[model samples]
Target: MRIGIFGTGGMADALGAHWARAGHELLVSGRSAENAAALANRLGAATGTWPEVAAAADVLLLALPAGAVLDVLAASGPLTGKVLVDCTNDPALTGAPVASRIASASPGAHVVKAFNLAPTDIWQLTPPAWEGRPLSVPLCGDDPAALAAVGTLVRDIGATPVAGGGLDRAALLEATAAFVIGLWFAGEDAQAILAPVG
Candidate 1:
């Protein structure tokens, strides 16, 4: 699979490394050509302009800031048929999901909301786990093939993919991230809130 990373930040470094190690071809691009090149070098991937990367990738990971995502997408040219995995979160708790916005911006792209729940360090884990259990990632997307593609990427990074309903439900996942991440910032065990149901 050819994966394009649209950011040069920690999220890109963490996840891109896994995909590269998993033998998927990667092309990284961002606002900063130098940073993008550096990240690409570190991951043994290639660097290109945003539009070039957009054109070349089978899957594109939006590891960019939530505020800048739409603008960047608009500049990336056509994204028809691309599996766009949105890993960005709007801390403002905006009513609409970023994935939905991306879908709106790129008419034919398959947008999947995923890999936004955890921190970069967690994703850096060989297989993020708690005790003896592998971490379960919740995925929200309308297209089956898109979800399946993102699911394979999630597993490549050592996480299980949990079906989180369709694109309409993605806002719930974003809200949950805001809430849980807030709890984490308060130095609380966010996972403690989710006791197993009988």
Candidate 2:
């Protein structure tokens, strides 16, 4: 897979490393060319302009902040028929899911919402395991092929991918993230809030 990551931040570095290790070709681009080059070097991937990366990749990871997603995509030229993976989360909880917004902004692209629940530190984990089990990631997307592609990437990072329904349900995932993040920030054990079902 030719993966284009549109940021040089922690999430980009962590996920890009895993995909690179999985033998996927990578092109990293962002607002800062120097930072992108540095991250590309660290991941053993290539660095290119946003437009070039967008055009060259089979799959594009919008590893940017929530506010920057639309602007960056607009600047990256047409995304028609692209598999766009949205990993952004809105801390403000202001509106719809970022994936839905991205889908609206790029109607021709297949947008998949994923990798937003975990922190960058968790993604840095080689297997992202917890309690002797691999972490389960829930993904929401309308396109079956796009979902399957991202599912492969999830397993590439040694995590389990769970179906999270269609694109319409992506807002629920965002709300879940906001709630869990609040609990985490409040020094509460979010897992304890829910018990296992028999």
Candidate 3:
């Protein structure tokens, strides 16, 4: 897959490593060319400006904070045919409906909501984390074809993909991230907090 990742932050770098390991050609972008190139070099993926990266990818990962996502997408131009993956959630985000808006903007493209429920380390699990085989990643998207494509991406990163159904289900997905962050902020251990789910 010709993948492009925006932000080049921890989550972006982590996910990019998984793709690099899987032999995908990855292009990473960030606000700072130095940081982006550094991360790209560290992960053995290609590095370029954000617009260049966005234009070249078959799949694009929005690895920015929720507050900045909309502007970033708009600045990147009409992502009409790209597979847009959003891994962001801000408790303070306002007036923007991402999944539908992104889909509408992209026309024939598919928008998927994912990777926001857990920390970056979730992808670094030594023994893959699904219930039966490894850890299961729950994703929600309105488009089935897009969801399936995301499932493939999630599976590529050594996770079991759990389809949480329509894009509206992101309400649950967003709230889940809040709860997880709360638990982590409360100083709970992974085993203790994830006990029920894990």
Candidate 4:
């Protein structure tokens, strides 16, 4: 599978490494062409402009910051019929879910919300395993095919993909990220808040 990554940041590097190792074709692009070229070289992938990446990929990973998503997509031309995987989390979360907003911005693109809850460090773990179990990633999207594609990518990094329902529920995931991030900063155990399964 050809994957286009839209950032050269930590998340892009971490996830891009996994996908590249999993034998997926990668085109990495960012605001800085030089950084994108460097990252692409490190990952054994290709570097391109944002428009080139968008045109070359079947799946597009928006690994950019939350605030930049709208502006970046707006400048990237049409996204009709594209599978757009959104990994952004807005700490403020003042508006609609990022995935929904991306859907509105791109119109016909299939937007899937994923990989926001986990920190970039976790993705660096080979297989992303905790104890003896693979990490379970929660995903929300309206399109089944798009969800399946993203799910496969999730599994490619040795994580389990759990459905978090449709795109309408993506805000919940974003809210959870904000709350969990707060707990992490406060040096609290976020797992203590959840009860054991019955």
lDDT of 4 at 9: 96
Candidate 1 Cα misplacement greater than 4 A, ranges: none
TM-score of 4: 0.97
lDDT of each: 0.92, 0.92, 0.77, 0.92
Clashing pairs in 3: 129-134, 129-135, 130-134, 130-135
Q: Count the backbone clashes (under 3 Å) in each candidate.
A: 0, 0, 4, 0
Clashing pairs in 4: none
Task: TM-score each candidate.
Answer: 0.97, 0.97, 0.86, 0.97
Q: Which stretches of candidate 4 lie over 4 Å from their true place?
A: none
Give the CA lDDT, 0 to 100, for residue 24 in model 4: 99
Task: Give me the displacement of residue 118 in model 1, in angstroms.
Answer: 0.8
Error of 4 at 142 (Å): 0.6
Task: Return the lDDT, model 4, position 162.
Answer: 99
Give candidate 1's whole-model lDDT.
0.92
For residues 55-124, what per-residue lDDT tens digits would candidate 4 score against the true structure? 8899999999998989989888888878999999998887888888898899989999999988888889
